[model samples]
Target: MFYLTVDILGTISFAISGVLVAMDKKLDVFGVFIIAFVTAVGGGTLRDILIGNTPVGWMQDPIYVFVIFGAVIFGILFRKRLKYFRKSLFLFDTIGIGLYTMVGVEKGLSAGLLPIMCIALGTMTASFGGVIRDILCNEIPVIFRKEIYATACILGGASYFLLRKLPIEDIYAYIGAILIVIGIRLFAVVFKVSLPNIYKVEQ
Candidate 1:
């Protein structure tokens, strides 16, 4: 139940984020829906394919499609209010990564993957959706930037495994790890923190 809830929340978050981006790009209704759909499930689809989860996830479950459709409609209707929030895209994207990271980690554990591989899968699951969305929108993906994006997922995934090693319950660890990812992302954004620039400045 908890896992389902997390997955649904992640779907909604990414869907809304995609809607916002597509709308900002002045896309039509169909374009918006397509972007939202891809942003909500692209990461999970890729992860499933890599792990040999045949048929992928969204195809096996129609709920994800319905959820993305609903989210796109909601985003379009509330776009004005969302614009007022200013950070709406960042907030939803952060939440999406936080939830999706754990979802992927759980899937990895179920598949009996090693801890490092699980963390990699978690990071990929939390990031690839946005990458696809960005590519479609003709923008650079956040994961390719120096932002604390996938790094947060890696850290959170590591924390989840570490927490599981303790005496605490799995649910608590799951929630804690999600919080850690969200917190790290929020902190990074709020403080303007990012990876050090690697390119040499022109004289």
Candidate 2:
């Protein structure tokens, strides 16, 4: 139940993120759909692969595909609503990170991975979709540029790992961990928190 909640939240958020970027890029309908697809599935795909789960997630659950496409149709019909979409997109994106991070960690533990590896999976599951979407769209991935994007997922996953050791119930623990992640991301956005540029050192 906890996992499902987080998964759906992330899915919707990332889907909106894709739509916004597509609109900004002036992509055609097909391009929008492609971006939507990539953003929605990219993280989960990486998570599944790292855990050695053959055939991956969406293949087992066609509903995931439907959900993403459903969002695409929504975006297409309501493209003018882009202004209104921004807040929802951010909310969903933050919530999704929390949810996906928790789910990723659980999957990792179930797969018998090390704690560090699970954290990596959690972060990947939360942020990789946006990465792929941005890359395909010829823009910077949100996770790479800072704004506490992947860091939120990282902290959320780690928090889950730590909180699970407490006396709290699993559901409460999970939600708590997710809240920690979402809260951080939202806080970062509200505060305009961002990492310093490292490109200056590239030369």
Which candidate gets the maximum TM-score versus the true structure?
2
Q: Alpha carbon lDDT of residue 56, candidate 1?
A: 94
Q: Which stretches of candidate 2 lie over 4 Å from their true place?
A: 1-6, 199-203
Instruction: Report the poorest 10 consecutive residues by lDDT, candidate 2.
Output: 1-10
lDDT values for all models: 0.88, 0.83
- Work out the TM-score per prediction: 0.88, 0.91
Q: Which regions of candidate 1 deviate over 4 angstroms?
A: 1-3, 85-92, 200-203
The clash number for model 2 is: 1
Worst 10-residue lDDT window for candidate 1 reads 194-203
Colliding residue pairs in candidate 1? none
TM-score of 2: 0.91
Q: Record all residue pairs in model 2 with backbone atoms less than 3 Å apart, i.e. clashing.
A: 10-96
